[model samples]
Target: MPTKELSPTELHLWNIVENNPEKIAKMSIVKLSQYAHVSTATIVRTMQKMGYGGYTSYRESLKIRNNSNSTFNVLNEADDKIRSVITKNEIEMNNTLHNLSYSTIEDSISMTKQAKIVYIFARGLSESIAEEIMVKLQLTGKYCEFHSDPNIIRTIASKIKKDALAIFITLNGETDELVAAAQKLSKNDIPVLTFTTNKAGKILAFSTLSFIGYKSKTNYFPEYEVRSRLPLQIMTRIFCDAYSVRANFYKSN
Candidate 1:
């Protein structure tokens, strides 16, 4: 991850409090929410994420351990900031994400115009997104390959036609493997497009086009991916629309 992803709230919240063990021991969901910028419910969820039942208990555990924490608090807070800044209030974050998602279709259409063979290399959660695109683009009758197997992703990436197009999806964007894969694709002169959560991340330097996704809504009370998933879904629909338009043009031939 980029050094800038660190948040001061995480710094203070995790900082060693040798002065008053009670503050760490007695921290509340409300106080953590105030600092973390996520909902109070999310703070509890954050505690749960750290293996505690809830926020108050999580803080108490910190008291037990003498406070040696790491960077995940910063990561979660950054997720909060992304949601706050990028998502629209009272709007179906899904709709907002769909609006942004069309750009992916636009990107696909542009690539299809040039690449006789298009290779999609993604893994993990991105594999789902890639497969959806592969099916949709196949309707155009253009040759498209979606590979999530790490070996094939790298192997096919190395062997792609020099003029082909490569699209990568890695939300974190700073992941070492994806970065290396992108570097390989770039060397072969294959245009690389990427979708990621952090636009300022290292992947942007290599990607000709990129999109950042953020969560729209959250109800930590019940547990969900409503905020982040909405934006991703939006991208999916948008890409479908753009590709549909391009597919029509191809049909004219």
Candidate 2:
């Protein structure tokens, strides 16, 4: 879909479809347009951007998938649970890829190449992804610092040079400390790049460039606070690989 390239009206229509996928599966193009308060042509264009030939095919596919899922629900419980998890992870990865903007990625790579030093910040599970980025960028011969501590992040944000780049990785992107640090960095005219699963995250306002990944809200374990980090990992892997290629090319040139 590359939703970042969508116009405001298209993005709005996408949000409506995304939030109410099951309901939308039953909707006609005219009905959806009326519901979304946009023209039918807008709805058709939005579906086309999602790689559908038209609204009818998109709705049909969703209906078929829903029917298949209903039929699959009668399977053995344990095997079904495992298969469902795999399916959800696959969908998340696919959605993340579709939402990614190549231009934004290239700009981020260029910014990293120009920076004297890169400061990476993350917490919890995201710290692992940040660490991977730190190590990979360092291997490309760039000076990098990785921090997971909130206090250290704020301190570094205050003291970082103007030419330095700050990359923040967070699942929700509402971390108070990270937002504060991003605000501080922006105040000092430092470029901030953010990777998050939340498109409307507060961190985006302070970011010079932001990449949004997909994370399913399905709670497989309602008893615990576990969620998939696969989307973030996928985004991190792509960015690191692209950065490495660009860095090597520039070095050789």
Candidate 3:
């Protein structure tokens, strides 16, 4: 576990868990709160401060690690690392699915189907994900454009038609310029959608509809990835499928 300065309540909970890891796997949030002598809200806030989205995610990760054959071997062997990543990604996907709002996904698919054209905005590694969306959407016969350059994105935002839809992909939703441009499109009455981290952030606030995806631990060295974005990739694929289903369903009607 990563070490950081902890508050008294957090420390108490940590000590109990550290001494009896097995007990937590079967414990609910309410049970854990009672065992720690803390309120459920405090437990939730403590988890968030420790980098988890919520209690469920925190507990799931702990359970996954506990089940692993050898935690220390995770970094010692390539095979172990691969296994570890696969397990963690599976957990993340389940967490994302459990938390997803079906209505929001339906709204996003409906918006895409109704749009005359689609604009995709992403940068760096996320640009590939955006490109995939463009390709899949275009295959459905919807006109699409992808933008990575800030100037071009802003230019398109200013001139986008009201019937068009904009989809932005940002892992952290901390890209100030992209958020600004998306907000502009919202102001123009052009529906804006986004794919972002599970935790709430700026871009999500203005999106006409948004899909939350799994967020893995941050990689300090860009060249060597310690966590995989497979969960997010699966989410994009699911979104494409949903778009196709909605389009065909309406067409048959």
lDDT for residue 253 in candidate 2, whole number 0-100 = 43
For each candidate, what is the lDDT?
0.55, 0.78, 0.69
Question: On residues 144-173, what C-alpha lDDT tens digit does candidate 1 reach at each position?
Answer: 888777776667767776556677767567
Worst 10 residues of 2 by lDDT: 71-80
With candidate 2 superimposed using the best TM-score fit, by how many Å does residue 42's alpha carbon deviate from the native?
32
Q: What TM-score number comes out for model 3? A: 0.61
Root-mean-square deviation (CA) per prediction? 19.1, 13.6, 14.0
Best-performing candidate as measured by lDDT: 2
Please, what are the lDDT tens digits per residue for candidate 2 over residues 18-103? 88989998775546756998754455556667876456556666777778442111112222234476778877877787777654
The candidate that wins on TM-score is 2
TM-score of 1: 0.53
Q: Each candidate's TM vs. the true structure?
A: 0.53, 0.65, 0.61
Candidate 2 whole-model C-alpha lDDT, 0 to 1 = 0.78
